[model samples]
Target: MFGRSKPLELNVLVLRDADVIATALRTALAAAAPEERPGLERAAALVEQAAAVPDAALRARWVHERLTAAGHEGPVDSVRAVKTLRESVPGLGLLSAVQLTKDAAAHRP
Candidate 1:
């Protein structure tokens, strides 16, 4: 008897390392549309900037600033905030995104 095929499931990629993030960005760039290219390029540049920084705290602070500027801060739902952060900064890992969300929530007005 023939076996049934399993349904396709979406997988989440947690990008933490700078090299891995840069590779993902490059792959995205290859397939992105004209309008989307600019944003992806910007994310790639951010990854480079973060990689160049030797201090971990400074990099985290820079990432937080970027996340806040993109309106991924405040009392927003944690799940949504993490998702938005990943979307905005493709190089951000799940743990970092969650921490950043909590940090934003703590400083909410």
Candidate 2:
């Protein structure tokens, strides 16, 4: 007898979830020093923008721009930053953890 396959589930960020991540980013940003706050603020703004866009590609573009603006460097540095954020703030989900580096890579020059 053939076994039934399990339904596939996409672990992506819904528009509403972007706000949750932004709130977490804001909380993290608030605890950062004034010198480090600007970068965090830029990222939070991008996340807020992503929340309003329904398209994944557009949201990814926002994440890419935020990563580059925040001086995330190449893919390795970008991935490291996302990992650090996820570890430091458990509320950040997997989609957010990979969004910067993965999408940025596609949009990188």
RMSD of each: 14.1, 11.9
Q: Residues 19-63, candidate 1: write the lDDT tens digits.
A: 899999999999999999999999999999977855444444554
> lDDT for every model?
0.69, 0.64
Provide the clashing-pair count of each candidate structure.
0, 0
Q: Quote each prediction's TM-score.
A: 0.37, 0.36
The digit string of per-residue lDDT tens for model 2 on 1-109 reads: 4898655433445356786898899899979999989999999989878677646566466555555555665563355767654565457575655654465456534
Model 1, position 19, has a per-residue lDDT of 88
Model 1 root mean square deviation, Cα atoms? 14.1
lDDT of 1: 0.69
Give the residue spans of candidate 1 off by over 4 A.
Answer: 1-16, 55-109
Report the alpha-carbon TM-score of model 1 versus the true structure.
0.37
